[model samples]
Target chain A: MTADVQTLASESGCHLFSGCGFPSPGLNVFEFKPIFSIGAFDFTKPMLLALISMLLVIGFFWSAFAKPKMVPRGAQNVGELGYLFVRDNISRETIGKKGDPYVPFLFSIFFFVWVMNVMAIIPFAQFPATSRIAFPASIVGIVWVTYLVLGIKNQGFVGYFKNMMFPPGLPKAIYFLLAPIELLQGLITRPFTMAVRLFANMFAGHMLIVTFSVGAWYLLGFHIGALYSATSFIVVVVLTAFELMIQALQAYIITLLAASYISTSLEAEH
Target chain B: MDGAAWSSVGYLLSGMLIYGGIGWLIDRWTGHSALFLPIGLVVGIALALVLVFVRHGRSS
Candidate 1:
């Protein structure tokens, strides 16, 4: 099967490049050699990007809010805009008035995801840290644990499970059929989709950018191919702009979903 | 509203995964092919719709 796939791939590559060696890009680009290792720990490009993104977030927020300004200026003004954006747009919109307390959590997630995704466009660090499933999976894990704990804490263990598995006001007999789905969705699919949604977006975005970039380079090899190279370069430019919007939108969506889950856990009924 | 819509998708996906997976297992066990998959998919969608209506369609 692997050989068949490779043959088909090479055939397609030849068809596209008219027998020229196109040097088609693949998943190999995502793989990286460890820069240095600390025993079991391996530091690589994506890991470095993640670390840098985290430090940037921390430093930016620290400078913005570390000193409380009665009249906001400089970093405080910028920080307030980000804080208020998350508070009003995501948290309050999703969770209502009581969402003020969770603003910090949602805000951090939104910006962290946004900055990590934005790295895909940054020169020299052209990789989205969230493209690695581990990062989004870990974030979703934290979200899962948070909402689960909140539900059990506020509603009691048995009550929370009951409320989650069996929606109130449903007919008694239908609960048997629906219970499994509800349980599976709540326990498994919720976090799974949450992580996959972000990871898949970043992964696909990175793949597209890489493909267009390589296409442009390969097409520029011949005089007649210059037009194709120019077209591919234009696509690369347009896609980069589009990717910027998607990165921010995905961050907003994940944070909004987190808030929604938290609010659902807190509520007595769906 | 958007939250409800997104979770509704989760409901649909989980419904299909759980029921369709069980159907596939049954097919494997019985050596029957393609028989249960369609049934599972339809039932999954039906149940997901009902759940969505209960969660979002009704006035709270």
Candidate 2:
């Protein structure tokens, strides 16, 4: 709906002084026409971007570490720095010595999400794949299953539930009231919030940029409105820079939370 | 610490959902308007706070 309005606005040279109203971006901005269809499924732009992000992550790391060098150089140096950043700052900080085994997982997750989010400002591919809830929800599903399985493996089936639902040192009489809350929090709320956090951040960031971009375009006239357009353009640039930082910060936060969840599963939380 | 903070949020949300839901059902069964919903929400928040303190705050 808004897409058609945007097209009409742009094609007809609609501006602040023009008879046509502002072409405001809305939820419709997130909707993309399918590029192709295979039977029941339709291939879309976000899906393609997500696929490219995954391949980019895999290809970069594969080439970087394909041939080990005692003295790191070029891509290897950059790759090692990225790898060590996740290892030391995120994984180890959250999961301790046992985190070494999961560094690869965390590294892949961090880079993949970062790349997907960075796509928002990358020229033609100006959309963050993580803005789509399905992407983040799927990642959260994997994390959810991993921690659940780890908890069962490490603490045994009953022990895992017991540890999760009944925190030690709580009053015995309150267990009945608190147990249900704990179970629901761990089982449902954690994954739901994790997915929503990433999706909402990217979604809001994209929305803000698009709003200002469209505003800048819509306000460009041969009058005082041009000044407002320039200001809107400036806001867009500032928002883009802010989003870059948020993208990295969100990636770090999600990965950190994943590591902590894994750590909690590996050993019952005290 | 970040993990703990996030967990506290989750606890509070789930507490509200669970208890507030129960309250809504009770209101339905008893035909009392707005009687239990607010009460349930308060109880839920209190319980969530207690749980948060026991799990995270006590460590310090």
Candidate 3:
């Protein structure tokens, strides 16, 4: 059954988008010229989609929260829910007592990311903005820079450098090897991984859905293996439910991790 | 032989595990939990492209 489904995906042509003879899993179908480039930076189709999604999200909530009703109605409620979710659930949970001050910043990150991921599920406009590495990486770079700048800004350069280098409560022998290694990690690896997490998950998830969707279409072609084809129908249904859960979970995870990073940095102890 | 093929498969998975181990080390060092995937995909892909298109193929 699995073998047959695999064969279906390989041959299926749903005409969703031109994938440049590459296995795009049918996500990026539209082609557009680059808008502008600053030095090495080239803005492409994905960036445009992200911008539009940002506008749409802002517009939706602006209209929602423009007037504060006595009893919260429509957009205000939704916006408030978003703010409360990240502020209370994520920031407080991660950062504990000191979370209130950082609530606004974390709320912005969480919503922007969640909205970008939700863009994929939006009908007619089916693009996951965060799937584009540039968008997520840019956000990650921002967060990484925030932590570095804030850490140094709050704790003087020497103090922050020392804080990162010799994390409190490490064995004495380990410091010899750990300091340079820790510095290297702080300087390089932190931001790199943060950006990649959102990029990989959304990228892979979208591809998988497209692959299966196209496979389902492909299987409807043959008569003899109709029973197995029916399973594709079932599989799609199951995967959709799983994908919805995962989509939200991934956004929560990204924000949760970000808050936790901030929380740990705020702590003097490890 | 078939044993060599199976051994190579084992080696590949183990390599991924080891790579992940190193990544976890970086995460622990930096106090940032999620940090490896972006480095691997975005920066790593760019590095590969530079290596291929701009670096190796170019001359001093």
Candidate 4:
């Protein structure tokens, strides 16, 4: 990664400001060298960002709810609003009334993902940790396991598969054609799409931002290119605003889907 | 409701992937070019449609 950066730097002849050539950002931007290593463990920028996001989520909620107030003031008031947002808007809307029990799970996933994505636009920390596939993949893995367990526990092992694969009103002969597809949908594609959806959104948003930001800075070098540079800078601003909406929407959709999956698992039949 | 809709999409994708994947393997084995690939893909889409309609389209 550093080697590519060096090549671009020399190619442009821009050690600080030497040429008007635009040096495009690529996959190398995503890879970060470890700051420090303890045995097999290596701490990198995204890892640190992810850790900070987790801490921010925990700290914010803990501060807001540690001491409950009768009338609610300051942090408690803000905390209640967030709580209700997840409960009423997401859980109740998607999973129905009984989804209240899973509100905490949904709330955590939503806020954690939101904060991680929002990091992309933050001034100093401009990279979204969720852009890395591992984060979303791991979270979806947990979600997958949670719903699968919930289904098996609520219905007997055989009953769970029976209900899932054999929906009523289907012809007997069609079962052979449908069962494998249904099983794949339930067992594999559900989680696969969940992970990819979040990862792809963040990944593409970050890349777009980098492309414009680099173009703007690169074009600023020549007097003749200044007008185009300003145009690129304007695009960067617009894209940043768009990224904010996408970040929040992706978080909400993932949480909403998670709740829906849990609710489906708890059902006696599909 | 949204879950059912997304589940429909998931069904279609996975069905095509699984069967189309099998067809690709068959084509490779026999060196028959593209004979089973389209067949697999159509069958996959058809089965996925049936699964979606049964699961989400019908009124219980």
Candidate 5:
């Protein structure tokens, strides 16, 4: 019940890398140690979690898709549905006809995030890698590079900047202000916002579960505590369901944004 | 419960702002998102380092 969330909150930070504690030495007592780091490469617990998530997602789907059947069943159906869902909703809709070539890339991003988010509320392994900003930022960075390079590759230097800077339908008089705003937004805000969106959601979600779970534990002590404790039990139950919904929503959002980038590029410049 | 007792919200918020701020700066300069990959790792570690020093600095 409260065990998994607790494990994640406690274990994630300190198991590897070293850091400071909260509430002081004998009080708040929370510190995370660095697992290992070089220049910018730190292998921490969450890093391991991220690796496992990628491996698990790829391995399971690979097995499922490895042997196709006339009529898909069990894991194969589940895996295929996951892939098809991204293909139809995200790739097809956002990028439209031109986005077909990117189906595999879109599918990987969607399903990978989908599975990582699913890990959070699954009882024993109640952890979400995206809760670590580094994790989501990495993916966002990758996606940003892909579209950015493509935008430049296809449109060329001045053309790519022009396309991103000035979208199709804008007042000519305002292109000066709007162009810088657009360029800046793409360069600075877009990927960070993308990473933070997923990171903030998962980070907040897991923390809520942990806080309330701990609150419930402490509450079981007496009359008020017990009453609040029992109430929290119910709250956790309801929140868990909502959290699952948010998990899927986050994955969809990431995939949708990726496809939208492609679609925007394909449109004729204004 | 692992290290300190600060509000989780405070730590997370600070992390978000600092990491985002630093990442933004790197993006502006390098024009490469890869610049952030290592930077985040550094900032997170640096944050931890600061935490270790801040409390210890006060304690002594």
Candidate 6:
């Protein structure tokens, strides 16, 4: 049987007093059966959701900006608001004047991530694609390449490593102890932590929602358990609302970090 | 700045991982269970703090 609580609930007809133990949701909930297979590839639910999110982002922008009025109305107006939000709050705040060129990149990342995260709250598509590590890892991979390339391009190859590993004004002797730390932090830890931060937040959020939802379902029955079920249901609702805010905040945070990384690459500090 | 603050965290964590890892290797090489691991961790944290101070502490 699928790990989905609703499916298990209907199939087993188990309730709090039914003598069967609670079918608590676990890590199994995150795993999905292949919707289809093509040679070596197995297309799953999260993959399908991520694909939809990308198309949604692309389609929205296309319609919004396809026929631009001198003064925007309808979708164009909303599109301008989204674009300006990223430009002003994220890109400009982080990268200044040079940030304008990168606004589209940050804008796309922000909205695509936001939509993927919001999928958690979306009925029937309750899983956030980002809760899966592969999605965030892929995004971080792009960011990793972008900053590394930009750093090398702006500072030259040797100069980039020099700036990253050997900050000026430090005593020569200390560099021996500190250079490796800097290298590790810059080259590996930064991107690793970025992906972990987004993935962990979504993963934990999804787990919490699933656990409470299953608890509620299992507790529902003709007994005192019904009241407990009501309480659990309330918690489920509250956590979902909290997840909504977290989804948007995570999107903003990742975008802001991306912009700052790009900015640091553009100009090396002494 | 938020970026500066967040990167400081990265610095601290990398410091621990790099040194802790080195310490672990030393332990395996020397046939001791936990001698250098703690020493490495302490040194790592100290260096990380110093790095944070140098980079973000004194903003002219």
lDDT of 1: 0.86
Lowest lDDT sum, 10 consecutive residues, model 4 chain A, at A1-10
lDDT of candidate 5 at residue A195, scale 0 to 100: 82
Best candidate (score: DockQ): 2
lDDT (Cα, tens digit) per residue for candidate 1, span A153-192 = 9899998889999999978999999999999989998899
Q: Write the per-residue lDDT of candidate 1 for residues B1-60, one digit (tens) a residue.
A: 667877899999988987888888888888889988878888888899999899888965
Q: Tens digits of per-residue lDDT for model 2 on A1-270?
A: 123335546566778867888767778778888999999899999999999999999898888999979999998999999999999999989899898999998888899999999999887788899999999999999999999999999999999999999999976999999898899998999889988999999999999988888888888888999999899999989999999999999999899989988998999878
* iRMSD for every model: 0.8, 0.7, 16.6, 1.1, 16.0, 0.9
Residue B5 of model 4, lDDT score: 71
For model 3, state the Cα shift of residue A30 in Å. Answer: 9.8
**TM-scores for every predicted model:** 0.91, 0.96, 0.69, 0.92, 0.70, 0.96
Please report how far candidate 5 places residue A131 from its true position, in Å: 0.9
What ranges in model 6 sit over 4 Å off?
A1-3
Q: Score each candidate by Cα lDDT.
A: 0.86, 0.89, 0.62, 0.85, 0.66, 0.90
Reproduced native contacts, each prediction: 0.81, 0.75, 0.00, 0.78, 0.00, 0.78
DockQ for every model comes to 0.80, 0.84, 0.03, 0.77, 0.02, 0.82
Quality of model 6 by C-alpha lDDT: 0.90
- Candidate 4 is scored at a TM of 0.92
Tell me how far the alpha carbon of residue A249 in candidate 4 is from the true structure, in angstroms, after superposition.
0.5
lDDT digits (tens) for residues B1-60 of candidate 3: 221222233333333343455666778788877797344334333322332222123422
* Clash numbers, per candidate: 0, 0, 9, 0, 23, 0
**In candidate 4, what are the lDDT values of residues A84-125, reduced to their tens digit?**
999999999977898888899899999999999999988777
Query: On residues A135-213, what C-alpha lDDT tens digit does candidate 3 reach at each position?
Result: 8888877777777777777777888888766755546785564455455445555455557777888877666665665
TM-scores for chain B, listed for all candidates: 0.91, 0.94, 0.50, 0.88, 0.45, 0.91
Expressed between 0 and 1, the share of native interface contacts present in candidate 5 is: 0.00
| Residue A255, candidate 2: C-alpha displacement in angstroms | 0.3
Output the number of the lDDT-best candidate.
6
